[model samples]
Target: MTEQTCGVRDVVDLGQDDGDTAEIHDECGVFGVWAPNRDPARMTYFALRALQHRGQESAGIAVGDGKTVLVRKDLGLVTQVFTEADLAAMPGKVAIGHCRYGTAGAKGWEAAQPHLSTIDDTIIALAHNGTLVNFDSLRRELIEMGIPFRSNTDSEVAAKLIGYFTQRGHRLRSGIAHTMRMIKGGYAMVLARENALYAFRDPHGIRPLVLGKLGENEWVVASETCALDIVGATYVRDVEPGEIIRISDDGMRSERGLPPADRHDCIFEHVYFSRPDSIKDGSSFYLMRHNMGRRLARETPVDADLVISVPDSGTPAAEGYAAELGLPYGTGLIKNRYVARTFIQPTQELRQRGVRLKLNPLPDVVRGKRIVMVDDSIVRGTTSKQIVRMLREAGATEVHVRSASPMVKWPCFYGIDTANQDQLIAANMELKEICSYIEADTLGFLSIEGLLSCVPSGGYCTACFTGDYPVEIPKSFYEEKFLPGYTPHNPDPSASDASISISDIAFDLKESENGD
Candidate 1:
């Protein structure tokens, strides 16, 4: 793979943060295409752009020709990282792509995916969408075995694990199955070798992955249906939990990699993670969020002259809330979308400017009006407080804030980069206290049950809202990291079924080797 040096213009990337904090950050996105005649790299590029809302820090694509796997990746948005010539150079049949927000590792060039690893004389690249809770111990074990590592990332750990097992005489699918059984936490992964592409998901279905059909032989897989739609692929079905599907010249093959546990699809995908156009269980996320707004209005009615939203993300819910309450809906704030990212160091004045760099209120719309602001969710309340102050400065008489989702009191262990329990505003403050902190005249958050009612019916991971984790985290890890008052609840006592000891895995591998 060739690395091209490109210069970035001098500006501040709001994403990198100039000391101001965002309410919530996004997780990662992954996509894969197994199209022979078509331009797989270009298709992946467009798909990554479609799924860009899922991540913004970095983007990468790996193309697997019949001879070798070639990758082009860097720390920037998809548009910034790739030129037309870059995609033209990588001609291949099978490909996988990733956009990263970096919840599991450092936000550096090395941490970008599709993470490359070698098995015997062959090469493979893996793109992952979620976090692996047990990766730290697994990395240490591999290190002691003399396996070299390039980055401290869960994705790298996974790539190495597959290579480790494959080098032990197992087939690539077997290696993937073994790795799936061993790794813990929520993940949706796409792996590509010289001629084949593989897609798999965690047992609990805590993350999302979908299968799509392009033509007779071509196939596509992605973290969301929106990516598939962008590439003209028709959605087939979700890549079933704990299942692995491999596509190649031999056609597609599916196998149970791990026994499916209780389905705990991430509810936040409907709340904020997935794109508005993305489909989940026969409904669009935009529709779901709009429903959430209607439910919120019924649960907590507010008397305000106008209803507005934080911006693009919260607009659907804001409209729904306004329609349901018979209140006027207007654009009280304008967002500077181009100001999403920058690298320039913030001076003290710029730090004080904060959210104004990204958002500004329109005095004509909000002046002398009682404004009700709707947002998807609030994490640290930093942005919310700043926005409230901005509205007041724009001549808003009284500001009321509403969250479409329930209070995010517990930190996420899946893919989302959430604050710790102590840093979470809701976890530290009660309703009135939080309202005062944000300087909102009034504040209301949708109830957990109310939120569930708005989405398509299925088991959901409400850990961030309810502290009920579908997969069990080690008590020691939580005890050492989190505050004493916060304890995660696992609904099923039997959920730790996949917590097999490393000795057991070794014994299992040895038995299989002897059988062969």
Candidate 2:
């Protein structure tokens, strides 16, 4: 790793090349509040910073100072964009913030959200975390109705649709109800306006949104409980799937708009996406991952002297696996903390080599030991194969592979960028075949039942594993399904099928001024 100085910060330059593979992100992160008497923007800034791990592409905050919504957003990390001055400039008692990693479409400032729409006299700011499967149909419908879009984001359509309904004399809650009926995908949004803040989750609850209370006067809504902790708020509970929560100075109220035909929280949250410190749907993410590792050990016993995890997401599970098998656990790999999510590489092959820049095997720890490697999930199998090879080169006699989640067979339509079916190794090959292909001595994945059991609540979307979608699956999907569309001059069909690589998805939105 090479170190370079940027402005007073030392940026570590990990010289690994980039790869053509794109990993799907779990969801986006969003936080919003109506603390009219407090500096809600500062609180939101901190909350978004805490949830930054969920997304790295862009960050922004919109403040409604009981009047106009003040907004700022850019394509960069939260810390890189929201300076103290920027946060202070956004002073308001009510604020909403979003951290986004684009799952599909081109990456640009225009796509960086806090998507604001004006209808009649009202302006609504929307930040969404999940994908909309029916976005094409919805976009066409809105276009036919003369609504012009500024970005290629589905959240904009949802915002415009809500704005249109609210302008036509429907209440905010009623507009949400009407909009929910038309959207067919996973969504967790926080909508804020001049006088109110609204939070809602899809019927399937494929994304996560929760409510919290800070003191007696301030109420908070966020994508995860971790964000609540950041703002010194006590976690209230998860915003139930299909539930609409309305918050204002008059106190909080909730109205159930629709009941889930099936409760399917995204299973990947526990396995790889969410912060270990977070509590989702009453389940401890850290504990759930630990249990998954323990179960993986029991189900797929292997002879190994040490258990090692891929850093960050895979650490807790590796510990659990080690404890279950009475094997020693050690920090066998280290990740360079400063690597940007999207690094510019000279070529696609060079990019594939970039994973090593982020992660490197600790040769001293793994040398001469039979290692059991635990990771969250295996998508295209390229990263896993690369990691395994790195371990072998570091002198491991054997590398036994295990995934904390079940094999993902189907692509996700609800915001997650697991877009191409054929790219998934588990989708096409048997366990034994995959093991050989990846050059692992043995490979084991958490069972779908085991995954469901790990969750605090029984309801969650394991569609990627079970191939059972909670909502009606769309016959066609957006081009930004898993990978960004190629430019006219540079078309790479292979790059277009890569999975969405961000960790989580959640967004905060505010109703347009006209209430429509």
Candidate 3:
């Protein structure tokens, strides 16, 4: 990583952009732990590290042991935000943490969460993963009622809403249920009081939340099964949609936060957001992607000398593609795993040079060959076009690009940061037009039916592809709900309170945003 300033940045990053414009960004990741007599902070840290791919903008952890609560979070990666000493200082039996991308609030320390609020003589810490469609209205209502807020995040709104209800007369679980009824949208939230850890999901299960056990009494909950794996916790089961699970000294109890309803869990979790190793319900994400690729090969017969994936995200599908086609798989594109976020002079040539820094072609492998490039999906078409051009320059005679998922024609409001529908290349063009635009000899996307067939037991959300939303979405909110573009606001060194510096930027879109 390049340092524009002399000092090392507090921001953390792993280098190399995948140069694929058709990428989907994930929303957030949340993890919590309740160990009877052990400090759960370290366990929470390792779990957050495993979930780092879920969010890169910021991270934080909060811990408590019935009487005292301590929080440590900042705007960076888990490795950058906390040291051994830092975790050692806060030794608590219960803890929860968050890794976030600035979706609901401005990009600053104020927006980072594990938001804390003390109301009615009770202190609550919350870390959430998902968007609240009605957050704006709720925030305004709470403001008018004389409830003070600490941050500009929708997470804080939910935390305060729970506190507001609790102060009135409801018990903690009852207040959470009341708050759940008042809110709309997908959420997988982990909340902590002095002695208990609570995990809850939206009524629709639009996001993922799993409950796990470390031993006889310890319990854990996280946005994905991967976090549970990182902590050596055995997967217990998925928290049911509309379920609220409380883990305390007595034991773990499950209660419904919202009434039972049809589940429309985000399909992207199977397609992108989740770690490949994670198992959702009974289906493995790895096996699902493999099925998509195997299906792609059967659906689209291509005359190619070899097949290759874009890298980690596209690898599984590429493996299936090669196996089904009986074609050899090779690493035609070598990704620079360590070249971090860097600033180049703002020149046209330098911009193109940056793409090469992320991915360089293996001339010996693709030279004079017909190549079929398998990628998860394409977004703006800019990165795909560049990659195709790069392949040609390396002496590839033809480039046939295939996407494992259907075209994304709509913007996602349930946490994913897909560019506006207008920004999506597929939203504006036909298959032939998109092929020509990206300079691919041919381009194919897996059919929606084919995508769904991978999972036999399915109630997944494909709203981004079919425009069929499971939950109520305020379409008008899109213009402001997700920011117009990908860039975070530039930091000014002159500002005394600026938490960011030239050295510490976890830069945007260029990196591997493999999941939604």
- Per-candidate Cα lDDT values, in order, are 0.86, 0.76, 0.78
List the candidates' TM-scores in order. 0.94, 0.87, 0.87
The candidate that wins on lDDT is: 1
lDDT of 2 at 481: 34
For candidate 3, write residues 1-516 as lDDT tens digits. Answer: 321211111111122122236456777999999995777999999999899879887899999878867788888778888999999998887999999876676778888879997756778899999888668877887787788886777899999878876654337887687678767778999999888899999877888899999997899999999999989999999899989898898899999877856778888887777899988767779999999888888777577899988877788888888899899999999988765322235488757564676788898999999999998887778778888888999999888888888888777778888736667877776566677777877677888888888864758778888767666655455554333443222123242212332112112211223332
lDDT of 2: 0.76
- What does candidate 3 score in Cα RMSD to the true structure? 13.1
Clashing pairs in 3: 15-339, 15-340, 22-378, 22-379
Off by over 4 Å in 2: 1-22, 104-106, 343-352, 478-516
Model 1: weakest 10-residue lDDT segment is: 9-18
Among these predictions, the greatest TM-score belongs to 1
lDDT of 1 by residue, 222-279 (tens): 9999999999999999999999999999999999999998899998898988889999
Better of 2 and 3 by lDDT: 3
